[model samples]
Target: MSLKYIDLFAGAGGLSEGFIRAGFEPIAHVEMNGDACDTLKTRTAFHYLNEKNQIEEYYNYLKGKITRNELWAKIPDNLINAVINTEISAETLPTIFEKIDSVLGKDKVDLVIGGPPCQAYSVAGRARDPKGMTEDPRNHLYKYYVEFLKRYKPKMFVFENVPGILSANNGGYLELIFEAVKEAGYELDKKVLNAKHFDVLQDRKRVIIIGWKKNLKLKYPHFEENEPQYEILKDLFSDLPKIKNGQGEWGAVDYAKETNNYLEKSGIRNGVCFTSQHIARPNNPNDLEIYKIAVNKWVQDNKRLNYAELPERLIKHNNTKSFTNRFQVVNHKGISHTVVAHICADGHYYIHPDIKQNRSITVREAARIQSFPDDYFFEKSRTTAFKQIGNAVPVLMAEGIANKIKEMIK
Candidate 1:
């Protein structure tokens, strides 16, 4: 028997993907974004394709060698229905519950996993709109999460979010969350975890809260006491084929055929030829020159650049001194800075180290930095792809937590 779980606020299924890779059976996933839901459906379908030896056909479709209809013709019909995409809301909760009940029947869920939208509790968001954030309905989204826990009473639950959550609403929000979970008869343990401390190549930090049913008497998970061998950018992406700024898409018929240790170690399945989402955006001439200057300064200034020191021509705006560390040339020798949704706006905060590249990092590079497997595809437009990747918890980080949960259960 396999452990069964449900995911809520499941953006592009990143957390769910990690659990799946850890050998759990995902019972259902709920997200409100249509584009992200589409991504979830296709990725779920791909898993089925893997099981049925139909991945080759899908790859052929990606290669543009076959019509969409031809690709569908060869895939199993059931594989197409592998995971149902439920766009959730207040009114739709009952219907979603009914579907979950019908699917699982009498089998109890082993775990419940998700993080409610965190913008209301993020430090950057609070800084941007301190007044508006206080009244934001998103601040209380955790209530819905608690409601699900009350209904299902899973053996364990994993909640993920930004560390800012600790002090959100001057500590009121965190208190409310703990009070609700305690009332529901669960013991909670949480900590702020850095991705670079767990084999990921980015300096991303997030708070993971784990709850076990009070009767279980399970030991809470502790951070790995030993120092982690943090991966630099090269460890994660040096094997990928290089691309110039504004480079058009380039994927071969059988991509992933030649992969590096990062891909293989990350468990990315082979046979992929061309990279997905590797296309770069055209850089503005001024920004292009700034990238060159930034990378050079980054290397010369001991891997750091001060925005105030740049020449006026390279400075995009006046009075920019306050935005110290505004233009960062990511150190290739060190772990990357955190990837965030702001990357969707522009890569100014995350420029490539190589001046020759002369542009912000591409979606694929961002995904790799987040520890997503090379073969893992981000769907919809490039903007949407960037947003999903930016907002995702690193797959490796999530997997490490899930594996610990699995051990506690056993």
Candidate 2:
């Protein structure tokens, strides 16, 4: 039988997707955003029907041929009901537990995976906040995670967060986390992991904490570095049709060129001829001009554009002293910088390396950089899609972790 697990604070199912690919069955996904919840359900439907060779039904939905309601009707009730949409808080814990209990129904939870939202623990977020996010209530959300571990008594768990988490609260919160987990009867180990090491194209990093039952004989899995088959611009982006600002659509877009060996080996250009969310965000005249300069600077000198060095006419912000190097072009020649949640607010930091396009990266490009497959759709508004993509753990990286986990558990 496949091992069962629960995902907490599941963002667009990135981590869960990895676990699922590694052969674990997801019993439940607990999240607060209703839109992300919809995405989780859609993906669940895809997995269930795809196993039954009904992927055409999903392709139909993505092609705009069928409504979401129609797609859900074909999926089983149990799979559709696994996603629980609500906040995990003190007031809501009881109800969440009751719902999980109903769904669990004698199934032993072999694992619990997920991390609380990282805003309070993010360095960028703290820099923008007045109190440095020390006063943010999210600092204590780990308490709720501990509550789940105690309740389920999973043999193992994976907790993920940003590097800032190690220093947040001067290490007070992490101390609390260790204490809480120990009190709940689990031994834990932690390390900083990079997605590039896991065959992901982006150089994203996260703090991964692994825990197991106190008496269990388990060790933190050793991960090895993996190299991708092609460059970011040449292989990852060449197949997608290019468009200018405010161009492209969420529906299907035909492949711009024939798939190469690198693309196939990377599992990026999967047999699908079309994908969704290739659309770019609309850009204002000033932003467009700046984007042109940013892309040109990269194409010529391979240097980042400084906000303070922009033409006088294109200048907008009064205080250029801070965030001077905000307009950064993605390093198309190699691994790109971290894909952060802030991209949803503005794409200035994520200017596409292609000068002809003359805009920020598209939703599909961002998703691809994060190692999400082309067919994995992010539901709801485009901005929200960006947010979900930005916040998610890279599926490629998570799969590597999951594979090791499967081996260890077995």
* TM-score for each of the candidates: 0.92, 0.97
Query: Highest lDDT: which candidate?
Result: 2
The TM-score obtained by model 2 is 0.97
lDDT (Cα, tens digit) per residue for candidate 2, span 222-321: 9886665467788789888989889988987888898877667656678988888899989999998998898888888888888999989999999899
Off by over 4 Å in 1: 66-89, 225-233, 250-258, 268-274, 318-321
Q: lDDT tens string, model 1, 1-410?
A: 88989888888877888898888887778787777776776676667678787787666655668754565455554433334555456777798788778767788889999998889999888988949489888888888888788989999999999999998888899889999998998999888889876677778889999999999997569868334443454465565556668874634422423566656676542545565667777788888887888888777776577777777777767767577787887777777889888888888888888776677888878888887765666766788888998989888888888898888887
**C-alpha lDDT values of all predictions:** 0.77, 0.90
Clashes in model 2: which pairs?
none
User: Which 10-residue window in model 2 sums to the lowest lDDT?
Assistant: 260-269
CA error at residue 312 for candidate 2, angstroms? 0.9
Residue 178 shift from truth in candidate 1, angstroms: 0.8
- Judge candidate 1 against the unseen true structure and give its global Cα lDDT, from 0 to 1: 0.77
